[model samples]
Target: MTTITKDNITDSLLATVHPNGNSEAAQVIRENGFPTTKHEEYKFTNITKRIESKIQSFQQAKPLGLTQQDVSKAMIKDLDADVVVFNNGQFSAELSSLGEGYAVTNVTNSEAPFSIKDLYDDSYLALNKASFEKGVFIQIPKNKVLDKPVLLLNLVKANDGQLITPKLWIDCAENTEAVFIEQTVSQDEQAYLLNGSVEIKTASNSHIHYYRVQNQNNEALEVNNLLTDIHRDSTFTSFVLSLEGDMIRNNVTLNLLDSGCEGNMYGLYLLGGKTHVDNHTNVDHTKPHSESNELYKGVLADTSRGVFNGKIFVREDAQKTNAFQQNNNILLSDEATINTKPQLEIWADDVKCSHGCTTGQLDEEALFYLQARGIDKKQGKALLLYAFAGDVLEHLKIEAFKEYCIDLVQKKLGTNF
Candidate 1:
């Protein structure tokens, strides 16, 4: 007889399940040390602590709200897009609506390109895959121009210690174009954890603009991954807006697989009170003639903590690659904390790559200048913070969404601009 151990639980949790959530796959991941207790990718973040607390297992045997009509009525007002809604890791077709530009389907009939099994040796990811529940599959056909953005919204409501695992796979075909927006919010204050994954595949000459707005409840725990594969001449861009949540960690990775592939990343996070936000990004150049650029900025107040870890890798054969990454942070309160690491690993001598990171208090002169113009100290501080974050929001393609980000920042920082 074979053994079924906690390691399988770890694999099921990270979401690389086999054709289904296979129990044996979990064992393989555990044996490989990918489920390390001290891996760098999970450094400073406590995963074992969550397990020690006996968090409840996630189940999707029954559906929540899943319907086009339900989604249109419950989601953020004025939001325009084809939407897939997940309530506690299960697809809710009734609570979600589809936008005009794309087609949305439940992944029950299909398989993901990469599963919790393929991409993770990390114990946490394995744990997710072993037990991944419901998922959403988005297909943007070849050469089709999406009429509207596609939105994926997740709501977590629990009676007790439940885990929510939601998976998403987005495929943009050749010469196709689409914009995807993902948002997570909760209707109740529950001590829940959301471990989710989003995988995007962009064909040659196509373009994808993706955004993640994390506005979950302060008591919720969120761990999410956004992974993308870019082919020849394709472009991928990301805008991440994080404001609420007691503990939130987001990992975004982009693989430039062919020549002329381009990746553009911009993000802003504002944390206040005791909230915690961590953003990690990676851009991998596998072929020559590729390019990537990243800029992430953050503002923290009260005793909040913000972390940024960005890595760029250029292979030996990836000559003529151009990659740039920068991280900037502003602290408003004495107890606020910011940790930043920007790294570059280049094997090709002919490639041009540069990375830099900075963290500090708000510009004193800028605040003083605004205050001298009859703005109160509070207002002046908020203005400076807004201006700092607005730079990232500018990358947003939708006018309303950009405005929403600015307004969210202002509200969280305590003075509207």
Candidate 2:
């Protein structure tokens, strides 16, 4: 396979521009280029080489002509929510059903709220901005509480080794409450690369809950970037559930720009085979009286690998801030590996902040005790693992979705709950 260089990676993509393409993002990618393993941000995850080997070209993937049945099959069981389906990076109206209290529109180059500075240093963000053919803009009105959650289903058919870029921007007005579930579903088992970006902005006195679910096949590879801006007197919560994939990288950044804002992040990744999952999170508290909490856990078996890098920043003027972060992992096999880094940078004296990480195998004594009590070995191990991941799952707000996730976790552990 030919090496994908920064100079030539964008050559075929930039040759043809969509009507909604961003020229500024193209320039940013042209100037900054892709990051190598030497880059501190991507040190543990070598995404460029993986892309070079898996992705045949940088061009867009062709649509799979997905129907409503495909969407129904991929949806969460017993989930009573509105659906918005994206087939290979394009929005599919035929497979989508909208409810009241929110509006959806098309995203153009000039309509994106992100500034050039946000795109200057990130190659993936710039690539998605420049190459995305169809993007969605969802807006929830002020003071309106949604009756049902919104499900953003991203369906990918990547048998052709094509590149798929899905872009979404969500805007929440003041005093509104909403829940969004963003999920990725792969249609086939062939190789492909998905570079997706989601940007959300919440106004004052609003509450937003965002859940991200990634359960792809062993041949699917993805890089997802989630950027959120939280305003005064509001709350923003995000949950990331990564179950399967070849190589998956998630970058989640939350900015609390005003006082009395609260941000929460939780993630769980279960890996087997040769799958690799990397999660990097940043929580910036730029105002006083703001709080943030983060917890990420992983279960690795076989020869899988997991990487976690979490950072919390408390600015000088951001007094009365409270931040906490933790990352824990369980290695079911000796060949499994995990690299975790939890950091806290505080500049204020009146703030409370702490960060820590731990990695170890399951307790043999506990397993033995359970086996001695009439429980089989596999069931015993699954029970222990479920208990370990129960805290993160308990944080989910929706009951039905939480049950669905619990079932999936049980199945992954090779036992029933």
Best by TM-score: 2
In order, what lDDT does every prediction score? 0.74, 0.86
In candidate 1, position 198 carries an lDDT of 80
lDDT of 1 by residue, 136-184 (tens): 7777888899877777777667554256678788888899988888887
| TM-score of each candidate structure, all chains considered together | 0.88, 0.95
Clashing residue pairs in candidate 2 are: none
Once fitted onto the true fold, the runs of candidate 1 whose alpha carbons sit more than 4 angstroms away are 1-19, 22-25, 32-37, 50-62, 65-74, 99-102, 113-120, 415-417
Residue 313 miss distance in model 1 (angstroms):
0.3
lDDT of 2 by residue, 1-417 (tens): 233565565565454345677887778777766677887888888887787677666557767878788889998999999998888977887889999778987776556765323412677777888778778989999899998989999899875537888889899999999999998888888888888998899999999999988898788888888889899999999999998899999988999999999999999999988999999999999999999999999999999999999989999999999999999999989999999989888888999899999999898899999999999999999999989988999989988899989988989987422
- The stretch of ten residues in a row with the least summed lDDT in candidate 1 is 1-10
- Residue 87 in candidate 2 has what lDDT? 84
